[model samples]
Target chain A: MGNDALNVEHSSGHSAAVFRETQDSEQFRRLKRKHRGFVLPVTAACLLWYFTYVLLAGYAPDFMATPVFGRVNIGILLGLSQIVTTFAVTMIYVSYANKQLDPDAAAIRDRLETKEGVR
Target chain B: MLHLAVTAPAAPGDPVLNIAIFGLFVAITMVIVFRASRNNKTAADYYAAGRSFSGGQNGSAIAGDYLSAASFLGIVGAIAINGYDGFLYSIGFLVAWVVALLLVAELLRNTGKFTMADVLAFRLKQRPVRIAAAISTLVVCFFYLLAQMAGAGGLVALLLGINDRVGQSVVIAVVGALMILYVLVGGMKGTTWVQIIKAGLLIAGAGVMTIWVLAINGFNLSTLLDSAVETSGNPAILAPGLQYGLSDITRLDFLSLGLALVLGTAALPHVLMRFYTVPTAKEARKSVVWAIWLIGIFYLFTLVLGYGASALIGAERIAAAPGGANSAAPLLAFELGGSVLLGIISAIAFATILAVVAGLTITAAASFSHDIYASVVKKGNPAPGAEVKVARRTVVVIGIVAILGGIGANGQNVAFLVALAFAVAASANLPTIVYSLFWKNFTTQGALWSMYGGLASAIILISLSPVVSGGEKSMLQGVDFAVFPLSNPGIVSIPLAFFLGWLGSVLDKKKESLEKQTEMEVRSLTGVGAEKSVAH
Candidate 1:
């Protein structure tokens, strides 16, 4: 929506104006809210989990070293779990995006490009 | 440099066989690139393969590009010697991918074109942000390329038993020339295909070694772990004290390293650039999912490969090798499968470098052509077909520079070199992405400050921080002028980079910088008016 920069000679002023208009549009705001709704809490939780593992490894060596099985200890279990958690989070995000975020985003795009015929 | 540190210059592995395997892989990659270039018609063709890749294919290609010699060779070797500490890197690298996939990848794909600058300048003032981003991309790409080049030279020399500078330079030159050809001819399409082949070969090679390791330990993971701890002869390895647990300072260093690895992988320019190779934002997300699976499986296999090397080869022997732990995999190959297997693994390692440097060369060339030449110099009026020509020329310049840098860095501890790149990416590029995507208040001034400040601080810290100027292990040798305590700079520079960005935006109340925040937000989220797929 910001200035069609490829052809526009004075793109700065025009680009900023286009975005200011988009900023005021209700559909843009709703689309952003939906994206933020799903993304924020998930990212926050993942970071917290990641840091806890890293901090435990850094500061609580004893906790990390506590024996879970014979030679397999708590630290190694946690480390492997980190890999497992990454896979789970990815699947969760992808499924959530497919079900919730993608449809609404596609709708917004269609409204812009086809309904309103905005370039 | 990392490989040379592990293995001494013993008689090289097998010149005739190594060369044969190396020649075969190189010749095939060249043919792929040569054929792909015939279809090249525009900047989009040169840069994003005309957005032709499906999610799964792009995913495989991303894995090929991301899994450089560092992950394939360095981390496995590091773990063989360092125990859980070595796999810590694997965790950091993987977790970072997850973070980027969930939060960043689609946005990058939906917003950016061929380079990081496209995304950064989406909302901010265009010229200044592009300039800052080009510099940051160049800095990150240069160091990463240098490390790959040096690693390739050392791996080849050690494998082929080449002892002198002449032999090593030949290795460096051949690699440089091949990579130049890939970028000049293949553009993104050829490079992506080469990366796919490399990823497949790497996975197969690593999978074989892991299976061999598991077979040796009777396929029981616990037994393998126990044997690893026992054979290591260092009880501390089973715990966390071997690599970074010695003292309080080292512990801080460990945390800093963790921060760098986790954030660094997300910010890597080449890795982010891969998202553009696919067309739709959905494909972008799928590409990341595919990368997670491939990278997840690959890293898990690396754990087995690492411990297997230790249990099978013994700690002292791995230490004694000229390349240190870097020789663990090849040595393990030879132990399990004899000379033929070792030769194959070495050849796979060479292919790994070729794919990685090709990816890096193109990314660097894009930063030069798209960011610097098209966006900055041409002032957004790039004529049709002009950008790709400049890109081809840029590839030659980068290839030559990398060859020289690699030759200069040969035989040094290139281990930490990649870490420095990660730190720069984390400190500089990550902030730029986060701010541009999330921060409504982010201005052009803030973007520039963050990019340059993070880049400069990372380089300065790394140069002074024992990696370059410390003791015998340091590149500077006997004279120790290293004042920076930790080798990794993430704990300091990353926060500083973010802070500078926030402060600069707050200070520079440019009304225009705030105006496009919503437009960038909408477009990045919903892909309105994003570059449509160019029909083939």
Candidate 2:
């Protein structure tokens, strides 16, 4: 896979041609699919949950004020839940990337770098 | 500035002790910064710390950079005075990190070398895009600097009882000089160390205060809340809407504020620049994880401290203090352990401002030198070692400007400056960044349109909003030209930016280079070619 003739300026169109080949490869596509598959929905869901909380805090103050237990109300509980959700999502993403995403990405990188004589 | 009924100007603690502790902190960090700057030989060394920091170290620095005086002091004071409503800000700030971790951080680290401009200019027309990014970066940094500087002035006034206008101005100048020295000597490597030390001290101090507050209430959270409500004589303190629930318009303002906070963190220039300090994308990811935990735990501490302050000192006295609500934490420190704790905690607050301003100054300097001077003016070829020298000079200029602005803004409500910075970042930078990374058809024209359009609209809206004019608490006193109903512009400007990006790309007949786009996509998704540049 080593092609001495293909080595040129990193930003030139010739090197980008090699990157284009990697971009179209099945391995590269699979890595992108895996990444977007995990990240997109998780991001949308978190944003949705966050906005819902914000809207309720803004518009439905009465609901947010409803007491849950003793002094803890719906607003306080919902706020704490947001904290929990944030930490949980971070851990989930990290674990998911470690198990599902990183290996495929690393393999694809190895192939690209080796072909480009970057070893 | 609206004059709140203030308690008499009496120093809360031993002023001499506070000054001595603060002096010690400055002397120690200055030594560390001097040691770190010895390695600043290349542009990479000056800008990204030679990509030398581990994930954990970078994470701690990121937490330090991200948690400005706004997060530490402002949010703490907000919660102490306004009850549940104040906690909302912490939630927004924290949740924004999820957007950063999942969407922005690793991809950015893999793609960009030093500044945010490196990524945005990667596939677009370098000259126009780089200039737009540098301008947006400088504006955001200046706004944030003003907030921190003004907060410093107020913090010192309350902590040491320096009430005269001239004394506050001198304090601002001294802080400016220290920030200049940190960046001039340490560069990014030194700045990162200062941030790390500050983060540790800040979290530790807040943790101590949180535990002390909890113990006094028998370690029961409900007991703390009950005491807060009982002391304040307002049961509404336990619920939402004390701050933002006055009317329908005020409620809408809360939504706008929430929108800005959630979207703003990922786009903030200084915050985004922190990703480059780590060598690999994996380290970037790990750094974000560490940052989320550290920042999350710190916010939790603030919650207890907020209600703790209300419970211990009563809301009336906190409201009546010299800096108004900003005085809560220092006042609570005085109440908790008398002068000694007050001295220590106040010194920590000063350290927070110093760490943050140094971070901002270096970031702005990097933007000016890397984007404007080297890339744009020199047309991408400068004499060896010229870039770092230019950066050092830019730091001095920024320090002077910040001192002047801080002195002018002293005693004003600096909160809106922070809000404006966030809104501009969310509206201007975030859309362009997302498009360049995710949208293949994103053209140079689209990038330019979104960057300039979003920046102008956000700034114009904020300037005309109630934050700057009209109402009693506005920055400009006794003016009524505020046509924008919402105090924050994010709800409107963010969507507009995204739309402009799409429309501009579609309208342009000439498309951006497909090869460049493909290259960027591959580089960002995988770590190929990223590590080599980072190592350089």
Candidate 3:
């Protein structure tokens, strides 16, 4: 099995071998766990915001239209807020993921490459 | 249902001005179509722009395809008449992309080669799952395509002063022909560029219109509100309609509609396919971020148009027009910018329909060719070039089906059909896709059960809804009650699908373990599981 693995690795090239061998690695497990944390909260927040707009527009029409401006209603404000929420969520996610998640994943990747060199 | 009175008598033949405008649009589209053909090459080139689209370019095309006639025309008209409730739809659409970005985009890019069915059925024995996914894809795409075609026909009739049927058939034929040429000649590369350019122009036009609208209202949000309030005869411009305002029922309906819009985008086969155009999962993520920004800005402009329509043209005038509130934006443009700008705006609307319908057609073709024909029927032995050829042929077949569906359902009530499509998408596709990507225990049986269950339930409920059953007029109208209110099944069906998927997965755990070998299939898909299992 080990020889077969090496032969397949030789044929497909190093990157493929690394990708295959890392499937059950601690690094992959950690990345997947981190991704879950990020994705769940973000998705939940978006869904919550979406429902809030709809609920406010439907049930509290008067409150939504509480007249921020002359004729601009609360519905319009909430509706437009959807656009703001989209960008806010996106920017926050990108910055956080790049700063926190990517570096950790990168460190693991470097370790894997160095291990491959030792092998 | 409103018919134009045609206040002015017909002066002579062909309405020369209308002919000139229509002719010019056709001429330009043809030139662009042929020029785009120059980029077409292999099957990959046809389906995914040769996987060469930069994040920004694909993002623009995604925005273009996403902003259908519904967003550009329907939301504006809805806002013009319904005020705040109308803008709710735009907000729902914009926020939906968040789901696309965080949950579906990177996963879809990593999993599937071409079609969404490929992603869903990735770990499963492909045949049954592929067949079911393909059917759902075709059904959803067909319904959506019909709505686009009908919108095209209506837009032409509204703009050119022609018989509605004649206008519709012309649009059907023209769009069908162009879509076929787009797939057969231009492929994905051409399609992407066309989508990108169209999206850019559409956004620019919306921005221009928004600025003009605010300028007309002197950029005073309060004054604009006062004018809208005065014009609308409602104290608040955002209040609910004559029928639905100040009611719990209406509020629930609004929330359901929003849920459908936000969740449905992640599930849409065509929209999901666009993420694959980017090279890596990282680029896929970046493209979605860009798409969110572009779509957000464009929707904000929609709010301006909605308010602008009421302030400038009067809601009553819009309500009285042939298509009722839907014509508000175009009419407002005519009043604000005169005939030339009206012509330009109208032309852009027409272009919007073509570009969207074309994207839908290509996605549908890929689903049929890749999922059903190659994967399921042929057991993945598609002889390399055979799959692409099959895909091109499917484009023509699907295009014809869409044209026919449009004609059959032409005047029957298109708005209702479109809402139903969104409902079905949110219910059937969203749950299955999300579970597959995120849930490790999601079994083939669970996916199959949830997808078919969601698809069947939404379709049945919609068919029995007041919108389709004609309210009080039909024989079963009194007895056959709508399972869900708001005529859209997203609220009920989406949750139902998720529950079913969870139940199926939980109950079938022992059987699921029998297929533990499938965990290795994930590596084949994400390039992670394959190496460990395949000795490579």
Candidate 4:
């Protein structure tokens, strides 16, 4: 395997022991709650948005037919916006990770590894 | 089934340029595979690309892997034939990335290494879940591969001037042989580089086609749409009635197809396997972001390519081509750009198939060697190189089966098969992923039930659906054998699979271990105690 960290696991149980400790820590629980709080609402919102577009396309042909501009109907406009929406949402989450999630998460990692190293 | 059993369309020139372009693409790809095979000394090197890929490279590779011939040829062909309805597929396919990028990538990265089996078996009882995971992965891969192989066989015949069935069989054999070699020797790194290069070429090639199409129409989309509506004689060129909203069955069918495309993309085993190629969860997320961008752009261009085909060549002529509407893209290339451009476009489409085939082959090989053979068959202690050896042999077997299957299928449209593949992925894989990662109470019983339940229901529903049973559009079209109302089964099978998973977990009454859940959560969230990479 190309993983030195994984190879070491068979010789010594250090990573597993460290993981057990990290799992028991309050910080871990906090991280889980924060992540769930962010991810669940986003998932729900995305699914809801996607289904709305699909359901509209399936059930309401006239509404989709109404053109917003000359020869550019509402359906075409809405379809194009789906691409825009994906990009916008992905960028939002990426920014959220950069600004909110990664920093705190990295701190927990560094602290746990240092304690393990000292031990 | 390879639709368009008829010969390739009558382009102005003979097959000289197309063959040359295709040969050049194959030669360059072989060089890449040769370089990549040298690094395949260890399991990680073979499977994860030594975790050496930068986020940008992996991201492009992901896009390449995700956008198969279906996106390039299928969607365009659908649009050319069905007008506005074909464009709806682009919306559904792109929307799927939102789920993959925001919700799934982090969890997949935290626990998964090598395969989706890695993620599912992370906290669950390993053996049963791994076995179930491997089986479902293979099933999905098999169907997906069959679709790709059929499409590739048809494509090869178009490019090489192969007229007879025997010639098509030879083409399938050659494709199968090359794909097997890439997986058996070059591994994921080789497959990935090929995908990245193909993605670049596809984007560039499609970009030029889109621009030239617009140039023909004086850079006005409405002009193109107007010509499309007029030529196609489909008033619903910019409306829903052309493809969907016609009848109750079609409406439901559209809904089901939309559901599968929107949900099934992330669940695809090959696409998911790309996640582990990067080093960290952050890189995985970024890779997804990149993929969404590229795929989104590619599909946007497809809008022009599809509509433009109707606008220029007229949808009737495109539909008249062998393989029906799928020839729209190639026909468009022939009409506007002549034989030279058609040759390049054909080469790119062929590369798209090859890159995807290589990706699928590697994932199947990984699932077999890592998930089943090493983890299940050998009880997690494989002899040195035994797993890799098994992986190599599996690739040969899969390649041969795929080639034979391609030859066996009568020429029919395989676009529906891609949708069915996605439906299977959504049904069989997605529920397991969602429940295992998020639901703390999710048990091994639940995981097994979801995978098997989803797999069986998807196959059963698809067998009963019109795609396999109804008319010329159906596998058994002439005789009325289909009892299922819809063509795709995601509308029914997906919800059933999720419910089965929930019911199984609730009923199992397995001993709850909060610590195990906590371990997975901590590692998944903070990226601590996750699998690590060592440079080769």
Which prediction has the highest DockQ against the true structure? 1
Encode model 4's per-residue lDDT on B1-536: one tens digit a residue: 33554455544435778768877988898898898778788888889988788889999999999888878898898787787788888888888988788668877887677899888877778788888888888887888888888887667655566667788788788878888877777888889988999999999999999999999889998888888887877767778677676798998888888888888988999989998988889889989989989999999999999999987888777766665676788888888788888888988988888889889888998999998888778777789889888988888998898888877773655557788889989998999898888888998888888889888988898888777877667776567777888888999989988998898899988844565666677667887656676476
- For each candidate, the DockQ is 0.53, 0.48, 0.35, 0.48
Ranking by lDDT: 2, 1, 4, 3
Best by TM-score: 2
Per-residue lDDT for A11 in model 4? 24
Kindly list the interface RMSD, in angstroms, of each predicted candidate in the order they appear: 2.8, 5.0, 6.7, 4.3
In the range A53-82, model 2's lDDT, one tens digit per residue, is: 988988888898887787878988899999
Off by over 4 Å in 1: A1-28, B1-13, B513-515
The DockQ ranking, best first, is 1, 4, 2, 3
**Which lDDT tens digits does candidate 1 get at residues B259-293?**
88888888888998888988889999999999999
Q: What TM-score goes with each of the models? A: 0.95, 0.97, 0.89, 0.95
The DockQ for candidate 4, computed on C-alphas, is 0.48
What residue runs in model 4 are displaced by over 4 Å at the alpha carbon? A1-26, A117-119, B1-12, B410-414, B477-479
lDDT tens digits by residue: candidate 3, B1-536? 22344462221123345446645755665677677666555555667766777788889989988898878888888888877667667777888888888888876775566777767776555677778788888878888888887766666566655554766687668767776776666666666766787788789888988999888778876666667777877765556543346466665665666677778878888888887777766677788998989998988888788888988878888877655666787788777877766676776777777778888888888888877777766766667688789888988888788777766655555566567677788888888887776777887788878888889988887776666565653324446565454567777888998898888778875444323223323332233211111010
What CA RMSD would candidate 2 show? Answer: 2.7
Estimate, for each residue in A43-114, the C-alpha lDDT of model 1 and write its tens digit.
Answer: 778778888988788788788888878778888899899999999999988988888788878877776667
Pairs of residues at least 3 apart in sequence or in different chains that clash in candidate 4: B2-B412, B3-B412, B3-B413, B4-B323, B470-B477, B471-B477
Better of 1 and 3 by DockQ: 1
